[model samples]
Target: MSQRIFHHPVLGSMEERTALQFQFNGAVYTAYEGETIAGALLAAGVRTLRVHEETGAPRGIYCNIGHCYECRVHVDGIPTVRACMTLVTEGMCVTAGSVLPTPLKKGGHAK
Candidate 1:
C-alpha cells in the first residue's frame, strides 16, 4: 500500500507551489522555498537529528521552539545556527555535528 506525504503549515498554507530540491545523506529531499532545514526534516518525520557533544549520545529536536540549542547544524559552511530558526534556501548545504560550541562570534559582529 502506498502512503500519503504530509507538508508543514508554512509550506501548505502558501498561495502557490514552491518546491525546492536539496540533498540530505546523499538523498534528495523536497521542501518548500521558505521552510527551514530542521522544519523540513521534522515534516519528513526525521528524529535524532545529531549526536551528543562529549558523551556522543543521540540528539535531535529537543526544543521544537529552538530554546535548548540541541538542534544546531552547519548550514552552507557556517556553524552555530538554530536549525529551528533558519529558513531553507535553494542549493544550500547542511551538515550535522555535536561539538560544544566555542565562546566566539563567528560573523564578527560589532562589539
Candidate 2:
C-alpha cells in the first residue's frame, strides 16, 4: 500500500511534510521529518522488520505502542531499538538484526 495518507474520512487530507532521507537495508528512502522508522518503512512497503532471535521467525510491528518488543531493529549501530517508538531522522541507518552474528541475514534478508 502507498505510504501517502492521501485522504481520510476522520483525519481528512494529509498535511505537507518536510521530506527527509534515511537508509534501510543499505538503500536510501524518503521519509517525513516526524514519522517513525517503522511507519516510514511500512509506508515504503516493508512488512517485515526482523527475524526472531530464538525461533528465526519473521517479525514486524505488533503493538505499535512500544509495549511489545516485536518491532526491534538496529538503528545507527544500536541494536534492539523499538522502531515503532523511535522517530525517523535524516541519514538514520536502520538494520534488521542485533549486533551479534545471526543465522539470518541483516536488514530483513532471509537466512
Report the number of the highest-TM-score candidate.
2
Q: List the residue pairs that clash in candidate 2.
A: none
Query: For residues 13-43, could you state the per-residue lDDT of candidate 2 as single tens digits?
Result: 7688889899988988888878999988989
How well is each residue in 1-111 modelled by candidate 1, as lDDT tens digits?
112245556657334657877765455666787777787877777766667765668777877788999888777778777888888877777777756764556656546
lDDT (0 to 1) per candidate: 0.71, 0.86
Model 2 has an lDDT value of 0.86
Runs off by more than 4 Å, candidate 1: 1-14, 98-111
Question: By summed lDDT, which 10 consecutive residues of candidate 2 come out lowest?
Answer: 98-107
TM-score of each: 0.70, 0.82
